[model samples]
Target: MPSQGKLYVVGIGPGCEEMLTLRARKVLESSDYVIGHRTYLNFVRHLVRGSIVESGMGREVERVKMAVELASGGHVVSLVSGGDPSVYGLASLVAELVYRNGLELDYEIVPGISALNSASPLFGSAISGDHAVISLSDLLTPWQVIERRLRKALEGDFVIAIYNPSSRRRAGNLRRAMEIVIEYRGDCFVGVAKNVCREGEQVLVMRASEVAESGVVDMHTLLIIPSTESIVDGNWIITPRGYSRKYELEVE
Candidate 1:
């Protein structure tokens, strides 16, 4: 088959049009079809002049397949995703599908700020040092593997940024992980940002033990467990870059 129109997998960045990257906005504006999850599609609905195709939860594969099929039919399709498309988003699936099906189509993965990035500013510099971005969701990855990774990250004393921490069906997952985290770093300072960069945005910073006790976290929250070395100065959190204690800065 002859080559088809380009497929731009654009990341809209944290459910806000203001946070959307310039390149991502341009790509979506020029696309012939905008495809994404219902939540993500709502973020870019005002910008999409083309056909808006959305899928329900647990229908990620269907969304990808539809985008690939549409682009294969010579439509300039924009596969929209919240946050960076390459980070646990739809870009990888789109690439994999195109490669496996031997589809002839030009495509681009436009990068955007991820949830962690959006939540970072709210927690000061807690992630200024080396940190691991781990998703607590075991829907795709096994729980055992996720536990192993958590253990390794804890052992390294690395700052950890957790995504998809909890949901209605998997409420105990975050609690279980918190147990492991406390065992390793019981007093580790934790910063939880809820609905980051969107409405109802709130930032809470407290001890890991508090997070383990509280049940406020949900799918929309982003958790940051900074190393024991991290300092909590007044209302700000900071992970120093080998700087002297007096030189450590604090900002909102």
Candidate 2:
């Protein structure tokens, strides 16, 4: 029996080549096959020296199965994902498939800069403290569950980072999210980071009440809804991580 080749689950980051990790780049360049969603594949097409297998958004299972088949045949494979693979990416799916099938596959997961990592800097310490990352897309998960999570996170005063907030078909989701946020926090600051590190990048800090009317959010947008303790200082939204209450510091 031929030895099974290694499968590398590589995170390509937010479409910024410089933000791509060295390990991820090396995996893409050295692998005999590179497989991923078409959008993510375009992000690192320049680095892939191997045969490319690109599929559409809803074809994740197909992509992973193809990658696994190639790797099982002694071909090194790199499965690319946007943002950190473990965070709402393909790493979990691949692991599930391998475990459920009882396949002994040699695999590794490479982390990369996620949207929150790339977008938070634009908000200037908006999520410096304890936070909750939630996805608004109800494709796989029910909306009621997502709403309950949002309410609980808000009630606990946790800063929240919302991903996949809205899209063409799910336009009302973000608006409803903003409503829930406003109910708990009473019109708090909501940071909208659109197309982070990509073309037409935009960062805006607006009130949660206004988010419903602003019409700025989309699928590419990541929201940073600060805790009640957070304050808007000049051009930045700063979340107080209890540093001042714990220690006395002289300000110049």
Candidate 3:
């Protein structure tokens, strides 16, 4: 009997080949089977040689089950995800399936840059200060839970990075989010980055009020709501804590 192969949930990192970590590349290169959404697979198609298993959008449960089955049946499998696999990716789902199905297989999660990380640099590190990251998609999670987290983050005055802010079928979540944020911090700074680290990227720096007024964000856009201390310097928006002393003159 042939030895069963292990599984790896790999993060490809924000739709860019350069952003893919060395370890993720190695795992994909060694795998005999690769599974992921078509778009994610396209991002790393040149880096690996394997039988591809493409998952349709919103079919995460099926994808996880298939990847585990392949790995348990003696095929080294690589489950690819955009950005960090553990962050809004297949890591948790795969682990859950393993636990429920009693599949004994070795697996590891390979981390990669998330869209939030990629967007931060473009906006002058808007997330440097305390912040909260949340996903606005309510497919798997209830709206009440999402709203509760948003309210808590607002009360804490933490900068916020929100993912899946809107979609064609769910166009009003971003506007609602802005309304909630405004109730706590009126006219707060807000930055939106679409397709970060990829071609055709768009970045918008504006106020939370403006975001609600404009109504232009979508699921691809990553929204950053700055705290009270954030400031704009020309094209860059940053949150500085008056730490100039770290770079100022020394006492002579």
Candidate 4:
């Protein structure tokens, strides 16, 4: 029997070539086949000299299966993802398939700069503390459970980063999320980062109550909602990480 080829689950990272990790690039270059959603494939289209296997959204299973089959035939394959592959990406799906199907495959997950990491820098000190990362997309998870998680993040005063907050079908999810947040945080401060490091990248900051009026968030948008104490200091949004005032100047 021919030895099974290696499969690389790669994270493209922020859609920026420079932001792509060296390991990810090497894996892509070394692979005999490349596969992912069409949008994600375009991120490294120019770099892929291998066979292109692109598919539309909602076809993750088909794509991963194709990659596995190709690798099982003793050909190296790279399955691509937009952000860090392990975080809400194709890595978990591949793992599930491997275990369920008993695929004889050798694979490694290559981490990339996540969308949060891409968008977080635009947030300044907003990520300097503990936080929660949640996805508002109700495709796989129930909205009720998402609501509970949102409330938990609020009650714990966690800085929240919401992924897949809204799309054409779920246009109002982010709006409802903002409403839940306002009920607890009162006047909520938020930073909405869209298409970070990509063409037409935008970062918009505003109060949660004004999200609907902001006219900026969409499916690609990642929201960094601050804790209750966070504030806008000049051009920066800041979330305090419970640091004491030991550095404060003493008064006579």
The most accurate candidate by lDDT is: 2
- lDDT by residue (66-180, candidate 4, tens digit) is 9888888899999999899887899999999999988768999999998888787787877777889999999999999999999999999888889998887886778899899
Question: Compared with the true structure, what per-residue lDDT tens digits does model 3 show for residues 1-252?
Answer: 779689999999999888989999999999999999998999998888878888899888888888888888888999998899877888889888888878778888899999888998898878886789999898888988999999999888787899988887776777788889988888766888988877779888877878756656877789988877777665577877667647764578
Best by TM-score: 2
lDDT of 1 by residue, 146-178 (tens): 999999998898889999998989978888988
lDDT of 1 at 111: 94
What TM-score does candidate 1 get on C-alpha atoms? 0.93
Better of 1 and 4 by lDDT: 4
3 or 4, greater by lDDT: 4
Query: Which window of ten consecutive residues has the lowest lDDT sum in model 2?
Result: 232-241
Model 3: residue 112 alpha-carbon error in angstroms: 0.9
| lDDT of all predictions | 0.85, 0.88, 0.85, 0.86
Candidate 2 regions with alpha-carbon error over 4 angstroms:
248-252
Q: Which tens-of-lDDT digit does each residue in 1-252 have in candidate 2?
A: 787699999998998899998899889999999998887888889888889988888888888999898998899999998999988999999999999999989999999899988888887788886899999999989999999999999999898999998888987998899888888878777888998998989999888888767878888889988888888865498887788998986788
> What is the TM-score of each predicted model, taking all chains together?
0.93, 0.95, 0.93, 0.93
Error of 1 at 113 (Å): 0.3
Root-mean-square deviation per candidate = 2.6, 1.4, 2.3, 2.4
